[model samples]
Target: MTQQERRRGRDETEEERADRMWGELIQEVRVAQTGVQILFGFLLTVVFQQKYASLSQADQAIYIVTVVLGACTTGALIGPVSLHRLVSGRRVKPQAVRLASRMTFVGLLLLLVTMGSSLLLILRVATNNGYVPYLVTAVILWYLVCWYGLPLWARRKHSSDG
Candidate 1:
């Protein structure tokens, strides 16, 4: 049987489906990777700034966590390219694409955490008020709604309608 015979959905052969799916996944990952890499690079430079020395202990902790999360997000977002490079021509394109999608999802989550923590730290340092956490949480909720919730809902709704 050809690759298409192995697939669980539709009539696409493995190669044809992988080719189509990989292209789409790559496009999605490209957008995510660019954003995370830029954010991660910026986070990496923050610690060397003179202003970093004046941050409170809590703020410092948040900074460290944010940076670490950014790094992880960068790694995950870039993982698909390396994975495809390593597994190319091995007849594992479907598996690689599946794994890459998971990585992208994880990277997005990490990016969210990094952004949320960065916001908390900045707002805390800028305002030094009890409302900092509330504001950060609200922004985080917005991110969740926009990034994940809406997309998932739309997908399900569209698919069901189809």
Candidate 2:
């Protein structure tokens, strides 16, 4: 096999590979975007709720942080579409795909934090229990294992086989 075939691990050219990667990335981003948007929308309304005024100062701070994280996550997930539109047909799909992938990963991390914080606030308010932090920590750990650990392990295990 030629060097190029070995490098790409496929018969397609760079442009074709970029196209495939871009499509897959966009699909993944679509799912994340929808979720973030919905979460952000809900967050935006929380401030106007009647019970919001009764929340403890600490809970208020947590809510603020969570909302900010959600906003940031929304921006990171949506950034690729803006990036693609601005750079379309510029022969930069490969680079764009790489950057977008990174942004998505960061967005996922932000989403994880936002969800954890949101959960903590809700549980603290609902149950008024001292164990809220521990529960949130456990849930975040589960998220980390599912979202990152398994993927990294599979990547390592499978890539070496090739």
Candidate 3:
């Protein structure tokens, strides 16, 4: 067997593994939930501002899309918690963890899109320069690198190292 396989937590049963995974997932969800909730709260307030009426039709459309994306992101990030609560007594934690993990992944993707859209809208309003799209693109690339590329690269490298 590979060293990695040997080192895997063979001591833990499926229930224990699920418990450990659930703890880790909750920790991760806490961070993301905080961010999305805060962002969504801010987005909610934007429509109430007087300046909201002054936005161009295109900008208004962007704002609407951004708000919806933020709402969806918030929902996805919080879904795991609700799922856990509803299924706490059932003997389905392993399945719950899997489902929660999927929800978290989807939440992160939505968060990424929400952030990108928010940035695009803000930049578009803050600058009339043609470089707004380029700037947004650069920032999105940076987000991708930080959020997915580095972890995936490490996963690949370390998995191969075993």
Candidate 4:
């Protein structure tokens, strides 16, 4: 095959492709990291609020779970930077990119759950209506469709791969 044919999507060598992908991955991670940081920080202060003492046992449990999920999400989103720092100059850029990509995907999933849990807690505290779970479920479904479904559909429909 010609050199161009071997390059497939881009006219770059494997190392060059890895470099580009790593840069893009880091940029994506930065956006997610900012959001998760803000959310985790907010979650941390929730226990100090006077209203926290009045929360029902179930709501308190939910708050604890949400805070934990926020922390995990923050860790996952920040993981790529640490991965790159440790793996840099180790001749494993491609592997690092793949691993970081996986971490970012997991981070996004965790973020979705965290946001949903936070919303559930907030809405439940705001009202004692029976429709809270249904409302939260609908919003979670919307998030899943927006974050995963559309991207997967585009990948399958538009990509060269079968």
How much does candidate 4 score in TM-score?
A: 0.92
Off by over 4 Å in 4: 1-7, 160-162
Winning candidate number (lDDT): 3
Model 4 lDDT per residue over 16-122, tens place: 99999999998988888888888889989989999999999999999999999998998899888899899999999999999999999999999999999998999
Per-residue lDDT over 1-162 for candidate 3, one digit per residue giving the tens place of the 0 to 100 score: 768666683679999999999999999999999999888898899889998899999999999999999989999999999999999989999999999999999999999999999999999988967999999999999999999999999989876775
Q: Which ten-residue region of model 1 has the weakest summed lDDT?
A: 1-10
Error of 4 at 147 (Å): 0.5
Q: Residue 10 CA error for candidate 2 (Å)?
A: 2.0
* Whole-model alpha-carbon lDDT for candidate 4: 0.92
Candidates, ranked, lDDT: 3, 2, 4, 1
TM-score (C-alpha) between model 2 and the true structure? 0.93
Q: Rate the local accuracy (lDDT) of all candidates.
A: 0.88, 0.92, 0.93, 0.92
The C-alpha RMSD of each candidate to the native structure, in angstroms, is 4.7, 2.6, 1.8, 2.9
- Candidate 3 regions off by >4 Å? 1-6
Better of 1 and 3 by lDDT: 3
> How many Å off is the CA of 81 in candidate 1?
0.8
Better of 1 and 2 by TM-score: 2
Better of 2 and 4 by TM-score: 2
Q: Using TM-score as the measure, which candidate wins?
A: 3
Native-vs-model 3 lDDT?
0.93
lDDT of 2 by residue, 115-152 (tens): 99889989999999999999999999999999999999
